[model samples]
Target chain A: MISLKRTMLFIPGNNPSMLMNSIVFGSDCVIFDLEDAVSEKQKDAARILVRNGLKTLDFENTEVFVRINDISTKYWKNDLEEVMKGKINSILLPKTESPKSVKEAEKYIEELEKKYNIEKQITIMPLLETALGIENAFQIAKSSERIEGLFLGAEDLTADLGAKRTKEGKEILYSRSRVVTAAKAAKILAIDTPFTDVDDDEGLVKDTIFAKEIGFDGKASISPRHVDIINKIFMPSKEEIIYAHKVIDAIEKAEEEGKGVVSLEGKMIDAPIVNRARKVLLVLNKSRGVM
Target chain B: MKIKNIAIVGSLESNDVMITIEPLENKLEIIIESIVYDQFNEEIKKAVQDVCDELEVKQAKIKVNDRGALECTIKARMEAAIIRGKGEIL
Candidate 1:
């Protein structure tokens, strides 16, 4: 089963306090950001600190990811070399503008996997932060088999588009839709950009709900305080769970009766509806530790 | 390895250890000042020594200001400080 990624929290790579306590918060994934979070001078220190943390710290079930610098920078190769020395689940490649960049990173990762004798494949999540990235989202998603998700980075995207970002996010609506559509087409997860205003709980709720409505599998969070809210929004509701159970029961009954069709609450249950119901139950079961 | 210059890494924050490395002409010296010095002084010294051994440092003055950082953290800071002091790119 694919792991749930309802909330991916960003922790500064150099902050030891945050790295040690990363799993204390209930985020499904924690990203050690070596890109924008750390200064250029401290990049080496942060890289070593994060690598050692990954080597020694026990994060249990929380998925660990490292946000390496963009491939255009001189630090990206070094970042990958250091971080790959330890255990990590994925690499969040920032400012991914083309399929070539994805392939470049993938080639290096392949070499590292062989060098380190890493048994598990380290996946890549492309951050579509630039206008070109969003424009070529589908191509980028389809570029590599290791691309697990397409992450929308609205802040830089808006800056690149020369548009002013607002609370309601009218400026990023098109970019978000494009990214989600591309990710779905590629059969990968679609992650929403983080709500930057950490203090505005109400805004966060609205933003997350909108993201869910538009078919986002998860959302990135800068602060730990936002994890619970994002998780709640992405999780199937109680009513949805009950309905899913009912749908399953109806399908089983129809199968026992040798009926060709199934219906729940006077509505015909087609294959699509049944599949949706099964997905809901699957998520519910996974969340409840019934996996 | 020779310590070519003075280099510092890490911070004095909670759960972090600040390591400073400088060139020394004669002998290797290590000084540790941690909040939990009474409990972890020897362990911290061992962590620093292990990193020095890994980096093959023969002459240097190492100072560690530990805010209760873990063994792995101390080693990382020490390695980074040594590399920087050697004027090497990481």
Candidate 2:
């Protein structure tokens, strides 16, 4: 199942109401945050809450990911102890600096799967937030087979770069490109960070367009209000879907005629164009829950 | 360990339950107030009972104000209140 990650909404682990209703918000993935969103005092409670939610709540059609504390923190092991006990789609590791960190996290995940007797494997989504992480993104993405995606944490990346955050997002351009390039090279999804300005719908659209232009698979969202916008922007448009169908049909006809080259709407189509159209159709099919 | 004073945990949110546990001398007393009490009252009581049974709690007064919380949440809150009432942290 190609998990469409058009919008990944974060729900605070301790917020029971939000956790229970996370699926109805229309986000493709709902991240139950046990890291930054939770305070030290409620860590245990939040873990328990999230585990219970995962065990009982039916998150129909929404992929569930749990963001555990970083490896540097003591809370991570305990977080895993609770998080691994439940059925989840993936684990998002924060502050992933090196490929070694990914490998270590995979090892821990394996141990937890054994301890909890969870038959299925849980994929990892390493968040590249630091300068070192950006530099080593490719290796980190390839470090573990369990890693299905890489997320660019712009907020923490900017902080690590010692640069002032801006709405223009020019400061982290190089880092974002590196993450996208790495994810592409490893054939994994590249998720962009959340746009902080929740009220600016136009700005969100513009930012999502920029991310899409730069080859991002999708973008994370903090508010449920942005889920529809993000999903709409990232998904293939109706015209594009029509074009994709034409492209595939043209290619199939060409193959039947023993032709090596194909033309669609008077423009020549090559391998790359055909592949891109196929991918668009695949994404479109996934968005409609056909795949 | 015996519970000391009254302790409350969890919330009154849409899918949460606020539970208060107080120490008692002899019998185990449980009072439940829920919007869906008639439909899920027995399940809610069983959840609290499971938690007490696990903790080996013999005597306590458990009050549950539920808002459609699941069985795991009810058990978690009951355990949290019981632990807090004992002046300890897990």
Candidate 3:
């Protein structure tokens, strides 16, 4: 069963308090950020702290990820060397610009997995944070077998584009659409950028709804308060679940009657519609812990 | 490993332990002051000693100011401080 990533909370790698209590936030996933969150002087300390945290803490059901430094930086390899020795679901690659970057990281990860004697291959999620990254999103998504998702880093991307970051997010519409399209085309997850305003609950809700409508599987959250809102927004609604069940029942009935086509409430149920309904049910089951 | 200089890691934040390591002549000394000293004094000492043993530190003065940190956290901060105290970069 596939795990749903409705909300992924970022915890600073250097902060022991946050690292110890990461699982209490009720996020579908937690990302221990080693890049932007940790200062250069404390990188080594944070790495050891996070590695120990992962080794000792029992995260049980929450998917654990670590956002390492960018591939071009000197710290990424050391970051991988330390964290790969512990338990983690994936590596979040920041400032990913091209397919080559993904491949480079994957190669090193494969080597680390071998060195650590880890049987399960760790996955990778690339953060598309630059104009070049967004432009080559499709190729990057298809770059490696371990690529689990495409995450948008709107804050950096906006800076790269010299555009002002705003709560309305009108500036990132095209980038968001391109990322979703690329992810869908590659059959991978599309995770939206976080809404930076921690105090603005209304803006977070609106942004999350827009993300879901535009085909994001989840959104990264900086604050624990945003997790519940993102999860609630991404959850399959009651009416949607009921309609999905009805669609499935109608299809089953049509098959029993040996009909060539299926219809529900006079609306033709095509392959795409049936697939969408099945996805809704799948998400529902995932949310219910049926996975 | 020998502690060459004073090195400090971690913070006094809640659920964290601040470790300070400095060079000592010929003996290993550990001083611990934790919020849960009455309940976890030995456990915290053991954690620091375990890290020291793992790092093979022959001599050092280790001061632990713990704010209810977990065992793992104590060990991590101790290891980081010891490494830094050895004049080595991690």
Candidate 4:
């Protein structure tokens, strides 16, 4: 079953306690970060720690990803070397500015898979963190078969655009929408950036709701506390799930009666509505482990 | 990196391990304090020894206060303390 990434918690690669406790928080994915999270001097040690952590620990139900250093950094190669030696669900490429960067990382991942003698296909998550990355989001998402999604890196993109960062996130609305559009166009997931202000739970909820309204599939987070909230916010509500089941049942009954058009509660259930209902039910069933 | 002084890493909380390393005079010493000491004592000591060997530290005094941490946690904390003792940051 493909798990929905409603929230991905980022833990510093060098932090032992955090890494050990990562899965307990119940994030859909736990991203062990080796890029901006680790200082330059500690990159080697972080890599070793993350590699060993991935090899030794059972992450329970959470998907494991390693956020490697940017392509521009010398540490990216070593990051891939250490992380690919272990069992990983995906690799997050930071500051991905173009489709070329995604393909380059994909090539390196292939080489590493051969070197490590590992047979599993490691997916790639390219972070659209720069102005160029945001502009080229669709290309990056469609660049390679390994690319699973696009992640919005609002902080870096804001800096690249010379825009001021604010709690309201007004400056990044266009970029966020563009990323979601590009991801949708490329048939990939679009993950929104973290709220950054850990203490502002209300702000996080607001931002998450806005992201959902704008078609984002998930949100990235730095704090473990955000997991439960993000998961709760992103999941289909009880009423929505019930409605989806009713829609499916009604449609199936109609088809059995040889009717092409279906209606639920006096409202016409067209292809788009049925598709939305099916998606909701699919996500619900996946979360419940019934699919 | 070379061992220069004393350093401590990790925590003493539940599910965590705190490690302390000090420069020693040509010998390695490891002391472990764990609730599951009877079952994991040797394993914890081996973890510390392995980290020390990896860092090429010929001599050091290591102490572990483990609160039910697994072998990986022990190794990570020990490695972190070892790096910090060697005047490096992980």
Candidate 5:
């Protein structure tokens, strides 16, 4: 099933406690951060610590991904090699400039995959940070078979553009739309950039709803505190599930009568509509105990 | 018509806390539920798995209210509740 990951929680890989705590933080998934969170001297230590952490306990089905250093850094290759030896769900490639970077990283990942005989296919999330990256988001998403989704890296992007950051995210509107477009074009999830304000639940919820309305699959969250808001926005409501079931019921009845199309409450629902409706049901079923 | 092990369950919904206890074969099984599961439309069984460990538990019932609990907190609360109910050392 294709799940829309709405909130990818960031956990500093160097922090053992956070890593352990995130095993059940209740987000759609988590990205163990080795790039921005760890200092230069601590990179090696973070890697060792993270590797040990993965082996220590089960993350209890939370999708584990690591955002490694950019291709321009020395850590990129070694990160790939070490992560190859560790157990993780996915890899997030930082500073993705173009499809070429994806291809380059995929080569190492593929080599590592074969070397380890890892059974499951590893996923890649490409972070679009540079203007060149934004320009080629579409191509980058298309470049790798492992590329699963696209995330808007606003901090690095603002630095790259030499633009002042704002709380409203208006400065990155063009990039946000572009990232969503590229993700859609490639048929992958569009994840919004994280809300930097840690204490403002109101702002977080507001931004999350905005992202969801703008067709993002999920938003990146800097803190665990924001997971509930993001999760709520992404999941279909109980009313929505009820309606989805009603739609499915009507479709079933129509099929029984050998009808090609059906109208429910005066709105016609076709194949695509029913498919999306079914996805809502799946999400509802997964989160049954949460509320 | 005979009495066996009894399981009592209740919840006090806090902003971030929920507790559940299920009595298994012998040891007390306890679980601290996460509100995050409420948003997910699927099975609560996943949440159950999140809190369970290799610890022995039987004849358990859990109750809890939370103020935003983490995974470790959830599991720890469950374990603590079970031990408290079991008349065992904490």
Candidate 6:
């Protein structure tokens, strides 16, 4: 239900200061990183910190998500257990290769929801990291109902392809296209990978616009610095919001006047079109300055 | 003393406590929006009492820019701000 076309910041799960400051950073969604972002020795400590942070902090409008280690690792089970016990909204499953992986993760999440007495279902964002993950993307997208979105881990995908990642991401274009196509086929949102170069806000903005144009709903960020630019590029402009309001008002007025259809900017509008207009307004109202 | 007097006023009326803390008129001054003020009354009260009790502080006035924060989140920010203010004073 969340579009999240804007920036999603990745906060190291173990860093208390970063996590504490995350809510203030203004990202549309905040991903508490527990995967390659942290070292093995500190995984448990990170989990504790993230759990305590989740327990202690108020993330408000910022959605809280966790990136868990792949099930291939020994730490995956414990990671899932700790994540379930906390107040996390979703779990980002890394290196997702097949639908079975999603189903497996969903079962664990279901168990956690029951164990914790949580009312809402904790959703999953399966990250396609490897070539196989990309190849089997369709299955992974269908693996579970808890899966509301799919993510790209471009660096890992590049590694899997035996190619180097560049600013243009040309080497991995095929895989990226495949991932997007699969996500579209599954009717899921395609979340783009983060730009490793933290200081290059221009690069981040370019890529964000590119991804959005290419059908990605959002782009992930390793550093918070990339957030503002990415957010600006993807956020529905103020003009768009005002236009949405105008369209909604006109449609309602026309309906009240017993008109069959209405036109906006020389385009026809119907019932379904009204719903679309409402969604834009809803997003604007929901995000406001936060976006 | 009740050991601590911590209070988180919604960004809207959060200043009520802050205005009362001022020495000349015994008040604190802070600005906040109205919507956050209305929705967060309970959490504000509980957070203030808890902060006052937990941190062993006396009197506080907090202002927040709530873009629809959760109850737990409001409490967390209150605790964090109180602790931060305490840390600064000490």
Kindly list the per-residue Cα lDDT of model 3 for residues B1-85, writing each as its tens digit: 7789999999999999999999999999999998999999999999999999999997999999999998888988998998899
Candidate number that wins on DockQ, 2 or 5: 2
Full-model lDDT, candidate 2: 0.88
iRMS value of model 3?
0.6
Better of 2 and 4 by TM-score: 2
Error of 3 at A18 (Å): 1.1
Q: Candidate 1 — which residues are off by over 4 angstroms?
A: A243-291
What DockQ does predicted model 4 obtain? 0.27
For all candidates, the clash counts are 1, 0, 0, 0, 28, 12
Better structure of 2 and 6 per TM-score? 2
The second chain of candidate 4 has a TM-score of 0.92
Per-residue alpha-carbon lDDT of candidate 2 for residues B27-76, written as tens digits (9 for 90 to 100) = 89999999999999999999999989888887899899999987878877
The share of true interface contacts that also appear in candidate 6 amounts to: 0.03
On DockQ, the candidate that comes out on top is: 1
Please give the lDDT score at residue A56 for candidate 3: 91
> What is every candidate's alpha-carbon RMSD to the true fold?
2.9, 3.4, 2.9, 4.6, 14.2, 11.7
Ranking by DockQ: 1, 3, 2, 4, 6, 5
**CAPRI verdict on model 6?**
incorrect
Q: Between 3 and 4, whose TM-score is larger? A: 3
Please give the distance, in angstroms, between residue B26's alpha carbon in candidate 5 and its true position after superposition: 52
Reference-based TM-score of each model: 0.92, 0.87, 0.92, 0.80, 0.70, 0.70
What is the C-alpha lDDT profile of model 4 across B1-90, one tens digit per residue?
A: 467889877667676788888988878888889989999888888888888888788788888899887777777777768777887633
Residue A235 error for model 1, in Å?
A: 1.3
Poorly placed runs, candidate 3 (over 4 Å): A243-279, A285-291
Q: Score the docking of each candidate (DockQ).
A: 0.86, 0.52, 0.80, 0.27, 0.02, 0.04
* Clash list (residue pairs), candidate 4: none
